[model samples]
Target: MVADDSKMWRTILKDLLSSEGYDVITAEDGLQAYFKIYESCVDVLISDVIMPGLNGYQLCRILKKDPHLKDMPVILLTGSADSVDRFWSMYSGADAYIEKTSSNALDNVKKILKNFKWKSDMPPQDGKNVFGAVLDELLAETTLRAEISELSNHVEDVDYTIQKIRNLLRSLFGIKAFAALMITMSEMILYSSLKDMKKTEEDLLSRLKRPYFPSYHTYRTIDGKEDVEGLNSIYKVISYDGKEEGVLALWRERSFSVREEKLLSIICEEIGGIFKNIIEVNEYRKNAYLDDLTGIANFRAIEGHLEKLWNSGKNFEISIIDIDHFKKVNDSYGHEVGNEVLAGLGKMLREFGEKHDVFVGRFGGEEFMAISEKSNFLTSVMNEFRQMVEKAHFSQSMPTLSISVSAGVARRDDFSSYTEVIEFADGLLYQAKKEGRNKVISYESIG
Candidate 1:
C-alpha cells in the first residue's frame, strides 16, 4: 500500500512498484492506508510521513502494535532530507526510511524489499510494540507542555513575541540559533540571534528557493548533513490572512526528535495569531498618543517628549500659542464651527512644523504648542509664523472672517525646570495679550 496525500506521488509510486511485479494498493491518507492494509494481503507499505487524519508515524505505530502486521516491512518516505525523519521512522517501527528527493530512492526501496523478503520466513519482532508505546507516551507529554506554554504566553510587541518564541525553542530543542523574517506590505524585517544577519538572510533566501514538499506543513532541505550554526537551517513559512507572511528558522547541533518536530508544528500553527495580536497592540498604542480632535500629537505625547528633552539636557525652544478672541468666535458661531476652526488651524500648524523640522501638538482648548531645537533663527521663525496666521483664512465657509494668534517663546537654558519654562512662556503670552493681541513675545523683547 502506498499512502500519500498527493495524487501525483501515489500514482508514480504505485506504477513503479507494480512494474516490479508486486501488486500495489494506493491510499490518499494514513487513515485510508490503515484500513486498506487490513482489507488487502499487503506485503509492503510505503507511506509519506506528512499526511492528514493520521501521519506516517502514527500509522507505523499502529501497524507495529498489531501482531498480524508487525512483521510486514514498512518503508516511510519523506520529502525532508532532515536525518531526524529517518530516526522518527525507525522509532515508529518502520523497517526502512527513504527521502523522496534522493536520487537513490527507488534503489533504496527495492533493496529494502529484497532484504525484507528474504527475512519473511523469520518470526515477527517482539519488542517493537513496547518501543512504539513508549514513543506515543513521550509525544503526549511534549504536546501537553507546549499547550500549557502557549496558553500562558502574553506578548505586547513583535520583539517580545519573537524573544518569547526564541526562548521556547531554545528550551525545547536546545537550538544553537533562531531567526525570523517578516514581510509586511510596507517593509521586510529580519531578526536573528547569531548577529550575522546579512549572511543569514542570504542563506535563508537561497534555501527557501528549493523545491517545496507536498504535505500539510511542508519542510524543505538543502543538504543531507548539518552545515554550520546557520547554514543548515530548517525553516517553516508562516501563513495567515490567506498569504505567506514570514519565515521562522531554527538551527541546532543535534537533530530534532520526533516529539520536538510535532511540538514545532504546533508552534508554527499558533505564531500567526501571535503576530496578528502584536500588530493590533501597536495600532492601539499609536492611537492612544494621538489627538482625536486635531489628529496630531496629544498633550500626553507632548509631555513625554518634553520630559525626554529636559532629562537629556538638550537646548530647545518652546512656543505657546493662543487664538485671539477665541471665545468670541465660539459665541458668535456654534461649537461645531469652532471645532472645524480648531481642526483647520491644527492642520496648518502641523504642516508648518513639519516643514521647519519642529514638533507641534494641541495643548488644550484653543491653545497649541510648538517645540524646536534652539537655533539662531528662532525669533525669526516665531515672527514668520505669527505673520502667516494673521494673513491666513481659517474657515472655508466663513472665509471673510479672519483669525490671528499670539505666541510666547522661551528657551530651555534660562529655566531651572521644564515646567518653569512653560509657566514663563504662558506669562509672556499674557503679556502679548495685555499689550495687544495678535503679537509674538519673547525674552529679548521683555529684556
Candidate 2:
C-alpha cells in the first residue's frame, strides 16, 4: 500500500514500485490505506506520514497488532533529516526510512525490498516443515524485535524532543517561564499521542473551514472561543490531492518585523517536514496497537502499557470507566450516534486529562481507562470530568440525551500485576453501576 496526500508523489511511487515488479495499491490518506489492508493483502506499506485521517504512524500501529499483517515491512518517506524525525520513524515501527528529497530514494527502497525478499526465500531445515514456514517465522521474529527496539528508541526521542521544544519555545518567545510551561503542556499532549506511538483531505473551499494556528495575537484573543476573527495572519492547512487533513498554524505577535516573515516561512517549511515525519512514524506505530473504529488503544496495547508501568514500580492510579446503559444508548440513538459518543468521549478525555499526568484511552466499545500518577488528585479530576459530561451539549438533531459513566479506580501497590490491577478496577466499575449509575468508586473501599 502506498499512501500519501500528494498526487505527484503517489504517481511517482506507484511507477517506481511497479517497475520493480511489485504489485502497487494507492491511497490518498491513512484512512483509505487502512480500509485497503482489510480488503486486500498488502505485502508492504509505503506511506507518507502526514495525511488527513489515519496518518502513517496510526496506520502502522494498527497493522502491527494484526496477527495476519504484523510481519509486513513498512517504509516511511519524509523530507526531514532531524534526529526527531528519524527516531520517530523507527520508533513508530518503520523498518526503513528515506528522505523524499534524497537522490537515492528509489535505490534505497529497492535495497529494502531486496533484503526482505532474501529473507523471505530462506530454506527450511528438515522435512518437518513447509518451505515457507521457516521464512515466515524468521520474518515475524525479526519484525517483532525491530518494533520493540524502535519503540524504546522512540520513547527516548520523545523525551529529547520535549526538552528541545521547551528550550526552543523559551528562546524564541523570550518569555522564559511562560514559554517553558506552555511548551511542556503542548509537548505532553503531542508526545502522549506520539507515544501512544500509535499512531484526510478535502477541497480548497472545504479546507478553509478547518481549524488553524493563528498569529500569536489572534491565538490570545480566540483562546476561549471557537471563533476565528481578527486573526490577520495566514495559517497553513495541509491538503492532500485536494482534501484537507489537518492544519498547522504559526503565530507572530504582529506582522513580520524585519525579514521575519521569510525566516518564519523557513521555519514553517521545517515544521511541515517534521509534521510529515511525525505522521509517518505515528502511522507505523499505530499499525502495532490501535482499534480501527474508536481510535483508542486496543487491548494488546493497553496490556503492554500496564505491564510496563507495573514493572517499573511507578505510583499510579488506574480506572476502568464504562458508559452507563451503553447498549441502550446504541439502541435508542443508533450505532452512528453511539460511535459519535465514543469518539466524542475520547476527545473529551484527552482534553481534560491534559490537566494532570493522565493517560486516557478507549479499552473497547463504551469502556475506557485512565491512568494517572497522582492518586490523591484523582477524585477532584473525576468529579470535574463528571460535571463536564453532565453539562455537555450534543447536536440537536439527535434525541435528547442525558448520559453518564460508571467508574472504578484502583491504586497500584507492591502486590499488583497488570492483570490484577485491571481486574480490580473492572470489578469496582461494576460495583459503581450496582450502587448507582454515574458515580465513581474506589477499589480501596472494596478491599
Taking the tens digit of each residue's C-alpha lDDT, what string does model 1 give over 48-93?
A: 9999988999999877766667888888999998888888899999
Root-mean-square deviation (CA) per prediction: 15.9, 22.1
* Tens-digit lDDT track of model 2 for 1-447: 899999999999899889989888899988777766556556788988778976777677666655565778888888777778788888888888899888999799888887774112222223123223434644644543443333333432544543443344335433212110011111212221111111111111133553333211101111122222332333444333344333434333444353344333443343333444454565666567766665557777778888888778887788888888889978987888887777777767866766565877778778988888776666667767877877774434564676788788888775437778778888888888999788888865666
**Would you list the C-alpha lDDT of every candidate in the order shown?**
0.75, 0.61
TM-score per model over all chains: 0.46, 0.44
- lDDT (0-100) at residue 399 of candidate 2? 46
Off by over 4 Å in 2: 1-275, 286-296
- Candidate 1 minimal-lDDT segment of 10 residues: 214-223
Clashes of each: 0, 35
**Maximum-lDDT candidate:** 1
